[model samples]
Target chain A: MYAFNYHRPASLAEAARLLASNPEAKLLAGGQTYIPTLKQRLARPSDVIDIGGLAELKGITEEAGGVTIGAAVRHAEVAGSALVRRLIPALASLAEGIGDPQVRNRGTLGGSIANNDPAADYPAAVVGLGATVRTSKGRAIAGDAFFTGMFETALEPDEIVTAVHFPKPEKAAYAKFPNPASRYAIVGVFLAKTASGIRVAVTGAAPCVFRATALEQALAASWSAASIDSVTIDPSNLNSDIHAQADYRAHLVKVMAKRALAAAG
Target chain B: MRISMTVNGRAVSGEVEPRTLLVEFLRNQLGLTGTHVGCDTSQCGCCVVHVDGVSAKSCTMLAVQADGCSVTTIEGLAQGGKLHPLQQAFHEHHGLQCGFCTPGMIMSAADLLQRNPDPTEHEVREWLEGNLCRCTGYHNIVKAILAAAQTMRGMAKAAE
Candidate 1:
């Protein structure tokens, strides 16, 4: 990795000031993806701000039938949180299944969503559960609006993601057919039954995680795995690679959606 | 940048480049070579270590990030010249052939045992996902961890 200045700010205000001042600075949260990118010389930031030490950005709070997770809260913490287990067990399971134990120990929810890797699991949860991303700018972006494209998000360079608020659902579950080597979702699906209606989000099969409206509508009509058997997912815009072709991912999306529905119950 | 951290119960400080990895700092700077770096990528767990009492991929973490933190490498496992129970179990069960992945395998297993004292065989397999053992089919490695867990549990019971 190339040499860069490192700054560890203890407060959110200090972090905001640092980022605003250093236009080429990048916030380092968990460093799971950032560190690897740096090692490969894929990115060159003038300064790397370490936000892991900021106490205000590290926790999980359960209140009013929902959970608010701090940006710096690690995936392992989410997986082990008793409050999350009791409130949203599906979310906990998704956290538990990310990467591996060592990776989970350091990967943070904020970093995961901010990076917006098409294959990441958290995006599916955020969009599927209709969660809210709170920023340091005092604005909350809905999950659907937060993700822009592959490795892209609505967050500005200086805007720090403070927390993610996930409203507890009646029932929700996520299922993924992971690539064996990378453990990234090949065609992951997150299905949720909310007060508003049924929400189905699909990840890894496209440039960005998206809502499967047809499957959601089918499942809303009949909450069964077989309900979406006739829904043919369009593969034209999905991702294609050596691991899986677009057509195969389209097929896996349907299979995973059904599995997620079965698991949500 | 100058950073300070507690490694293996010793307060260590060093001036390093911000890009230096924790594994590189331990192996090259501090001469704590027990922590191996099998893969530069985070996929292999050969560089696994305990940072603030949780298993983390050392290669993926910058040395500056570990400032003021408590770190425990495989070298820190044994106490008073005696091998840690996991080390003893691995020795008895023939858990390794090349021994390249032993340090990391032991560290990951130790972390698992810290959180779940009595892990089932299936649980052990699940927890070892981060650790990759290419030499042996992970059969003996799993046996070694289970045996170590049993011994540790028995020791705790006796103490109680």
Candidate 2:
């Protein structure tokens, strides 16, 4: 990796100040994604602000309302936490099933969400669960508005995700078609309940994670896997990578949704 | 860059380049070769280590990020001429062959057992997915962890 300045600010305010001072600075969360990009020379920045040790960005809290997961919490924590299992077992299972044990132990929720990898599993859960992403800039972004495209997000350069709020869902499940090697989702589906109603989100299909309105309408009327039998998602907007073609992803959207629905039961 | 960390109960310090990865710092500067680096990307687990008791891919972390944290490597598993239960079971079970993936497997396994002591075989396989072993097909590796869990339980019973 090319040489760069490293800073570990003690507080979020300090971290934000550092970013404001140097507009080209990048926050180092778990480094599972960014470090690789750096080593590959995919991205070069003036400085890296390490946030792995930021205490405010760590923890799993379950209160009367919902679960507020610290943005920097590792995937392993979500998969193994007692609170996550009891509150949202499917969410825990989804985390547990993410890229091998090492990745889960090292990759952070904020990092994965911020990078908005099209094949990542967390985006499905975030959108389907109708979560709120709270940033260091004191701005809250809904999951629908957070993601824009592959390797892209609505996050500003100066904004840092401090925490993500997952409102408790009545019935939620996530199913993914993992790459045989990389374990990234070829297509993943997250089905969940929200105050507005039910939401079905798809990832690894299009340039960004998106909602499946067709499936959601069916499920809202009848919360069963069979309810989505007639629904057919269009593939025009889906992405085609080495893992699968657009047609395959279009097909996976329904199959995985049914599986997730069955699993949710 | 100059940084200090409590490595396996010992205070270690080093001066390194700004882009020095934690794994490179440990192996090149500190001479803790037990923490191997398998892949440049964070995909491989051969560089896994404990940063403040949680398993993290050292290759992905910058050395300076670990300035004030605690780290535990494969070398730390054995103490006072004794081996960790996992190490003993691995030796007895032939959990390793080429040994290239041993350190990372050990680090990842320790973290897994810490979180779930009585993990199922499927869970073990799932957890070990990040740490790739091109040898032994991971049969003995899983066996060693199961045996270590039993040995740990026996030791706990004896202590009681």
Candidate 3:
């Protein structure tokens, strides 16, 4: 990795100030993705602002109708949190299934959604549960609007994600056909019955997490896996790479959605 | 930049480049070579070490990030010239072939045992998803971890 100035800001205000001042700076949360990108020389930044130590972006709180998870909270903490397990077990299970135990120990929720990797697991939860992303700029982006494209987000260059608020769903479950080698989702689906209606979010099959409106509508009519048996996913826009062909991914989307629906029951 | 931290129960300080990884600092700067680097990518667990009592990939973490933190590498597992129980179990079960992945495998297993003292065979396999053992087919590695967990549990029961 190339040499750069490292800054560990103590507070959110300091972090925002540093970000605004350093145009060529990158925020380092877990460094799970950033470190490797640096090692490969994919990115060169004048400064690296480490936000893992920020006190304001830490903790898991249960509010009136939802759970607020601090941005810097590690995956292991979320997977093991009793409050999370009791409130949103599906989210906890998703966290438990991320990269690995070692990766979970360091990787943070804020970093995952902020980076917005196409194959990441948290995106499924964030989008499926219709969560709200709080930022250092004091704006809350709806989860649906947060992820824009592959490795892209609706976040400004200097905006820092502070927390994610997920409203408790009536019933929710996630099922993924994980890549055996890396544990990333090859085709994953998160099914949720929220106050608004039924939600069916699919990840790893596309460039970004997307709601399967057909599956959602089918499930809204009948809350059963069999209801979506004939729901067909279009393969033209899905991801086709060395891991899986787009047609195969489209097929897996339906299969995974059924599995998630079954699990949610 | 200058950073200070506790490694293997010893307070250590060093001046390093901002991009230096924790594994590089341990192996090159501090001469604690027990921590191996099999795959620099986060997928491999060869560089697993306990940071603040949790297992993490040292290669993916910057040395500056570990500042003021307590770190335990493979070299720190044994105490008073005695091997940790996991080490003994690996020896008996022939858990490794090339021994290239032993340090990380042991460290990752140590973290698992710390959190779940009594893990089933399936649980051991699940917890070791990040650890890749090309040789020995992971059968012996899994056996070694389960045996070590049983031995550690027995030791704890005896003390109680």
Candidate 4:
């Protein structure tokens, strides 16, 4: 890991100030991904601001008929939170299935979405549930617009995510075919019946999490697993790697969508 | 940066580079080699330790981040010169062959028993997903953890 200056700010404003001052500064949330990236020398930053200790970004609250989770809250905390379990059991279960026990203990929702790994699970939940991400700059970015591409997000260089607001869905479930070693999704699908309409989000199959409009339309019409039987996913836009071929991921997407729909029931 | 923390019920302080991992600090600075580094890629749980009573991969955590937090390593498990119940169970069950992953397995199991005292066999196996036993002695490891859970439950009842 490259030697860098570490800063632990007392407030979000201070952290933002440090970021604005140091153009190459990176925010360290959970360090689950950042630390590994550093160890691999994938990134060299002039400064690292630790936000894990920020009191302002550390709570789970019920607000406006949904749940607002602090950006720094760990995956294990979300998986174990009674509030999350009661309000959005699907999200809790999604959190539970992320990585493994130790990774879940330190990985944060904000960090996971910010890193925006193509195989990450949170992006599916964010986009499927139509959640809102609040930033330190006081911007609420829709989940659909938050992720730009693999390892990319809509966040500005100095913008820090403060919280994520997941509105209560009528029903939601996530299913994934995980890689046995990394536990990352080879092809994952999140199905949600929201106030707006039926939504289907697929991850680990593309450069970014995307809505399966065909599956959404079919589920909206019939709300049954069989409704998506005729809907075919194109393999051209999907990711193909050693874990699975693009065509195989395309097939798993439909299978997982069906599984998620069944689980939502 | 100078960081201070409680390790094994003793206060310790050290000056570490910003890039210093907690595992490195424990092993190099403090000379606590009980926590081994297997993969160093965060895939293996060889560096499992309790920070503030919750298990985390020390190799993935920065030493500076552990400041003001209480850390419990595998070396801290014994009390009054007696092995922890999990340790005793592992010894009796021959849970290890090379003993390379034993510390991490024991620490991970300790955290599991703290949360779920009476874990089923499946739960024990699932909870140990992060831990890797290269010797392929997972059957005996699971057995030991289950047996230790029972013994710990009995000890709790005896105290009651």
* Top-scoring candidate (lDDT): 4
DockQ for model 3?
0.91
Q: Give one digit per residue, the lDDT tens place, for model 1 in A36-115.
A: 99999999999999997689998899867999999999999999999999999999999999999998999999999999
Tens-place lDDT per residue, model 4, B1-160, is 9999999999999999989999999999999999999997998899999999999999999999999999999999999999999999999999999999999999999999999999999999999989998896599999999999999999999999
Query: Model 3: which docking level applies?
Result: high
Between candidates 1 and 2, the DockQ winner: 1
Taking the tens digit of each residue's C-alpha lDDT, what string does model 2 give over A1-265?
Answer: 8778988889988998999899778888888888888999888889889887789999999866678899889998899899999988888988987887767767899999998998899999899999999999888899899998888888888889999998888888999988878888899999987677989999888888999999999998888767888788888899887778898899999999999988888
Which docking class does model 1 fall in?
high
- iRMSD per prediction, in order: 0.7, 1.4, 0.8, 0.7
Which sections of candidate 1 miss by over 4 Å?
none
Interface RMSD for model 2 amounts to 1.4
* Position A94, candidate 4: lDDT: 98
Model 4 agreement with the true structure over A72-165: per-residue lDDT tens digits: 9999999999999999899999999998899999999999998999999999999999999999999999999999988899999999999999
Error of 3 at A254 (Å): 0.8
Clashing residue pairs in candidate 4, if any? none
Q: What DockQ does predicted model 4 obtain?
A: 0.90
lDDT of each: 0.94, 0.88, 0.94, 0.94
Error of 3 at A112 (Å): 0.4
TM-score, one value per model: 0.99, 0.95, 0.99, 0.99
